[model samples]
Target: MPADPESGQGPAAADPAQQQQQQQQQQQQQQHADGRPAADKPIKRYRRTELEEEEAKKKLLLLEEEGDEQYEEYVPRKKRREADEAVLMRLQGLAGPAAPEGDDDTGSEIDDEDEEQQQQQPASKAARPASVPQQRGKESLLVQTARAKKEAPPESATDKVLAEEADMMRHITQKQALRAAKELATDTVYTRSMSTGWKPPAEARGWSARKAQALREQFHISVAGDNVPPPLPSFALMKLPPPIASLLQQKGIKRPTPIQIQGIPAALAGRDIIGISFTGSGKTLVYSLPLICIAVQDEMMMPLEGGEGPLGLIVCPSRELANQTVEVITQYTDALKAGGFPELRVMLCIGGIDMRAQMDMLKRGVHIVVATPGRLKDLLTKRRMNLDICRYLALDEADRMVDLGFEEEMREILSFFKSQRQTLMFSATMPAKIKTFAESALVDPIEVNVGRAGAANLDVIQEVEYVKEEDKLAYLLDCLQKTAPPVLVFAENKRDVDAIHEALLLQGVDVVAVHGDRDQLERLEAIRDFKGGKADVLVASDVASKGLDFPGVQHVINYDMPEEIENYVHRIGRTGRSGKTGIATTFINSRQCSESILLDLKHLLKEAKQRVPQFLTALHDPLEEMEALAALSGIKGCAYCGGLGHRIADCPKLRSESKAQERSKKDYFGSGGFGGEM
Candidate 1:
């Protein structure tokens, strides 16, 4: 109780009477004009107007009457009701009309009660009145609340909007389903009615193996399939359409070739076929006639519209083959059009040509498309063409396509087709890979082989000569002179073709050359001149080797022996066409020519009954000879590359190719590369 120097008047301030008097004085000082305690009031950051002050006073009185717990819950409930009312008003506006009378009576009553409470409150008290009357015949508020608790609540505006959206989506889905059903019906009807009216004859249906073998021997034709069709004797017996028959007659085709004998009927009967005959043996007609017939049938059934067509698709390996195929198809199509049949449209899609033109042709609707694999794949990738309606797919010169590394591209192109199609694979040889691909891609294909696959044309007199590497250019002219004008000289590479072409040109010979390096126009002109007799000698690489028809070509001179025996077969096949005998002269040497090819050539010459050179005869190995004998007996050889000289394990070409691939892989993806160490 002692007053220290740090405290002033501490003892007097501690007295109870003094403290009470000071508190009273302080309370009096804090009082406002309305006699409310200032300590209970909230601090105002900004001055309020008269209306805000009155509203504040009303809220304070309501809170005091209801207690803190009821005030907190009731105020939030009131706000929620107001917000829902605003949303309902917006939803009604979007719905384009007012709601029905009794649909929302509960909401309307609650809104009315709120409005009356706000209006009837006196300036002194903000508490709601307890005696507010309910609408006539309506349930009391407490009873309505109890009923709502027992039943599902009315749908909110958001829920109604979601329901309407779902209903609209269901209607759209139903419409789409109906449209799809109609399209499916149309497809079914079209498929049921479509037919080519071709059936196997009685003689073709059943025949003993001995009789079949004898017939095959007579015609030198080998066939393999279930229910193989017999060979037709004459063109008239084929029972082709009148126009086609007449056209064949006009073209002086009185009899069906060995390939056409069985291929045509099987194709017309809607069976997939693997046609393997020597080159220039009227193989084009086998696929062309069927393609035109199918296209004409499709056109007659329903005319093609824009962005719809190409019932037939022929994929070739090279541009020349594709163009040649298109020409063959066009000829028959023209014949059909002249004979009062539906006019068929044939398109040639190849590389080195403007794509816009091809696109325009597609826009106009084509009935048949003959295209090389590369260009065809490019168009398909760009979505400029589709195979939706195509029913006939012909892989012409399929061996050549596979050799040119187009097997993967062909598979990709096949994937573009959405449905089953009659696939025809025509080649001079059926390698094992091609056979496997055919088995996987085609459906029970008929294999029609005219004589042995990869056999040289017997009609052509094959003459092999040994010439030094330096002496080949000089000896080429003498070989060209063995036959009359219109001879084809083949080289293995473009450089040799150019060398031979230039030598012939400088020697005052009428010769033109073509290779992969030439432009499209140059190649076209070269072929035109050669075929039209404007040029006496046409020098070319293997580009002209496959599937090109040269009328009256009496001689084929190989400036250089091709690496592959299959190419050799195709090269000499340019002559001896259409049953006309011709001569083939091949130059060989120790260097720049593999012994395996020479062995294959010797076997081919011996098979064709042509004289073989002593060098080729001596170049053969005993193992190769054994394999060749087995190939002759079992018809099995290097089925991978169609080589008769070796099996797959001893294939020099495969070995070299594998080594090259390994080297390339090492170069690109060895250590410190993308693939890391191999």
Candidate 2:
């Protein structure tokens, strides 16, 4: 009773008195509630060995279910509602405002009224009302979402800066004005000369051998001379003195052109050269370099006397050519002086200026004289100029000089020079007569022919039209409307030149006319205006064909076919110069196509690889047949009397025989005899 083994009981709870009281209370409670005293719960216990066996059994049956299941219920993935989904989508679409009848699947909502308006009207017409302030915005927004959208407008050319620049350009002075004009001219030449896609050589030394070879092949350069000099690899290889070479470099002449390549060396070596190249083939430099080199040498060797004549003489065919040559030589000589070389004096003795001034300049001692044949011959006759001491002679446009009937003057000028002087002849062509003249003029000359003799510039695209003489003005107007300035128009005579000039003026075209009839000042002014871009077109005769270098000429129009085939080559060469491409349009009448002209033109086109017109190709010149007939008949008809061997115009036998006949007649019919009366 002191303590129970498994129960936490104090000695007081085990007391006898307390037990007796508890039994009494329990008996009472039993009687009151008909309940017996609460019985003690029995304790259940297991051996430690049984507990271990139970844990072992549980471990052995580990796969047996433990408590509640944790995995999701097995249900097949919900089958796709194939047919029902379509109905659902349709229902969803129907739930929204019903789409218009012709509406596409685009999820846009359109007003019923706007839809009706769009359906009732054409598509191009806007559906919005004019009175609505937001009409354009609404339609543009709609169009932004539509299948087709209108293209945006192009940007305007007028900008704030452009307006200001234009205003500023209008206030420039004459010199500044010329500068602006020449800038455009230079820009045109630069743009055309260098292709947009071409890049400079990487090394910058000069054109590589591969590049130079490509140029030779492209330009079809043919070189034939004693020890035919290889094209100068660069200006450095020219073997020129540093001053001269640097001067050329400063002038923007980095390398030799095809003509200059072969021609310069031949002339420099003291060989008489017959340099044949197309116009603008850098022919000026062919003789110019030699002239300068010799001048420098002559000056360095001995100081000039006050009355000494020019050391070098260059004769051109026209005053314009002589002037142009003088200007170019002056530029180069100025460059030479800038490069530390002795000052070389160059003067122009061309006509249309003061002869007395030219005489005065000559007396003061000039190094080089560029003159036309007429003026030079006049000076020579008056003893104002001398070529007796001249060691260098050049005849620029030699063929043209001869063609212009300057043979006597040329012979006279050549005779005045020492027979031992070196000579150089540059011509666009070398015809039989020029060849004969060259034989007498030049000794042991090296021939440098670039391409074919008298060939058109390949850079010029030639087009021939069978136009009537009277309709040329109308046709030219049409062409001008399509082409850009500056245009050069060639006519056969001064009358036609003036007529075309007047017609162009009437049509409100800026134009100038130059011909033989124009005074020197007037002609110079016309050329100046044309070059300055003040005149869009220059109407001219054959006088503009040779030696004048007009910059940035984009087109050449031949309103009249040249009477001579050689002149044709020169006429078209006006446009395409210095590597710039141009177009040449020739107006020809079928009736005027002579056999010689037709043959020459066709051959030229074929050689240049240009397209030949159908009319020109189809034409059969009858003169060829006549020439064949004449050859077979051995007629060799004369130009004057239709006789053989001798032209009646220059036949001494005919003249003498006529004189003898006249004398006999007078003798026979003396004093009004019967023969005279009959």
- Largest TM-score belongs to which candidate? 1
Each model's lDDT comes to 0.74, 0.68
Which whole-number lDDT from 0 to 100 does residue 587 have in model 2? 92
TM-score of 2: 0.60
lDDT of 1: 0.74
Candidate 2 deviant stretches above 4 angstroms: 1-231, 241-244, 621-678
lDDT of 2 by residue, 228-310 (tens): 33455465655676777777777677878878876776676677778888887889988987788778877888968777869
> After superposition, which runs of candidate 1 have C-alpha atoms over 4 Å from their true positions?
1-195, 201-214, 624-636, 664-678
Clashing pairs in 1: none
Q: TM-scores across all candidates? A: 0.68, 0.60
